[model samples]
Target: MSLAELLALVNDLSQSDKLSLFKLLAAQIPDAELQVIFSASEYPVWSPYDATEAANILMQMIEDDKEASTRA
Candidate 1:
């Protein structure tokens, strides 16, 4: 489902239900899987795990962009 629809559904829920729903959602999203997603995306995706190795890659990209912008 889309974010707008999801938000609407969340808002329709009671506070207790909302927390439970959030916990359920959170449980489905594993950190290892999230790390993989962050690493593979073209855009910068932050990760807590060293497994993704995105920090070095993203930082280098950011550095390159900054240098390019300064040169321009």
Candidate 2:
């Protein structure tokens, strides 16, 4: 659907439903960017553990955003 249609539907939703939709959308976007602290001749390091940790952090950020939005 178009953005206009989406906004129209969102306008019809109750506050709780709108909040839920906001959470879903927020979870799909990351709130931060990882900076690569690399030295000359060295590449940014990444491991399975780092990937898992990043995912957890992103989820936590999304939850935090949701909570903050609810308070507004």
Candidate 3:
């Protein structure tokens, strides 16, 4: 299923059901990996762009950062 469809299903879940689902998924990852994922820099709230547009925006940001790092 596409991410949008998966997100739609998740949005329809009850609070307890969401927690259960989160636990189920989280259990599959090792503690160390989860810690690294959680510790990564938090992304800003998404702007009102479609998924494709948002992905392009992020790609540009990544490339800009790469260019800046190369200059430094």
Top model number, lDDT: 3
Q: Report how far residue 47 has shifted in candidate 1, in Å.
A: 28
Give the Å error, residue 50, model 3.
Answer: 45
- lDDT per residue for candidate 1 within 1-72, as digits (tens), equals 999998998899999999999899889999999788789847688668775566788888999999999999
Best first by TM-score, ranked: 3, 2, 1
Top candidate on TM-score is 3
* Local distance difference test scores for all models: 0.88, 0.82, 0.93
Model 3 per-residue lDDT tens digits across residues 1-72: 999999999999999999999999989999999889889997799666568977898999999999999999
Between prediction 1 and prediction 2, which has the larger TM-score?
2
Clashing residue pairs in candidate 1 (N, C-alpha, C atoms within 3 angstroms): none
Stretches of candidate 2 off by over 4 Å are: 33-72
The whole-model C-alpha lDDT of candidate 2 against the native structure comes to 0.82
Please provide TM-scores, in order, for all candidate models, with all chains considered together: 0.40, 0.42, 0.47
**Candidate 2 TM-score to native:** 0.42
